[model samples]
Target: MREYSYFVYLMASRWNGTPYCGVTSDLLRRVVEHREGAAEGFTAKYGVSRLVWFEQQSDINQAVLR
Candidate 1:
């Protein structure tokens, strides 16, 4: 079977600032989107663009559960 990886990530506006949690199969692309405010949503509105934390998972379900 082909191995797959997913990520549970946290982004913040600043140090101990507003936070956003998300799960994605493409962490880099997702982070870039947040950084660029490409999506019109909470992260864009709240300026949550700094990558604060992340965890890797073996499956989408595991990443979502995290």
Candidate 2:
């Protein structure tokens, strides 16, 4: 049996400001990718790269809901 962690994360430009919501299986890698602008889309366009908040879920569906 393999254990997997799903994360619902919020990224912001600065403290208490515009936030971006996302979910990923690898939170650290995903965050790093966003910071590097490797993620093609809104995050890359808007430059949302700072991690502000995150939540972990055992299932993908639960993480998506979060």
Candidate 3:
């Protein structure tokens, strides 16, 4: 089995707030970027900065399809 570093994650504004689904290799950095509003996008606009769920995949294809 080859090593991989892909992740599918979910971010939310609050426990019941709107959820945002995404994929990234660096989960920490991505979350931080979202929190800091590094880019003006969906997560930033909807305040979906809280990590709610995550799962790793073997590759980008798998991660994206997930």
Candidate 4:
């Protein structure tokens, strides 16, 4: 069987500033999108693009639940 990885991540506008939570299999791409304001939502509106923290998960379910 093939193995897969997922991530649960936190993004912030600035230190002790607004925060955003998300899950993705492509952490780099997702963070880049947020930084470039490529999506229309809370993160873009509030500039929550800095990757403050992240945790890896063995499965998509675990990442999402986290």
Candidate of highest lDDT: 4
- Candidate 4's displacement at residue 4, Å, is 1.2
Q: What lDDT tens digits, residue by residue, belong to model 4 across residues 1-66?
A: 999989999999999999999999899999999999998989989999899999999999989888
lDDT of each: 0.93, 0.91, 0.90, 0.94
Q: Give the TM-score of candidate 4.
A: 0.93
Model 1, span 19-66: residue lDDT tens: 899999899999999989997979988999999999999989988988
State the lDDT at 26 in candidate 1. 93
Model 1, CA-based lDDT: 0.93
> Over 4 Å off in model 3, which ranges?
none
Residue-level lDDT of model 2, residues 1-66, one tens digit each, is 998999999998777766899999999999999899998988887889999889999999999987
Per-candidate total of colliding backbone pairs: 0, 0, 0, 0
CA shift of 59, model 2, Å: 0.5
Worst 10 residues of 4 by lDDT: 39-48
Clashing pairs in 2: none
For each candidate in turn, the TM-score is: 0.93, 0.91, 0.88, 0.93
| C-alpha RMSD between model 3 and the true structure | 1.9
lDDT ranking, high to low: 4, 1, 2, 3
Tens digit of lDDT per residue, candidate 3, span 1-66?
768799999989989999999999999999999899885878878887899999998789999999
Candidate achieving higher TM-score, 1 or 2 = 1
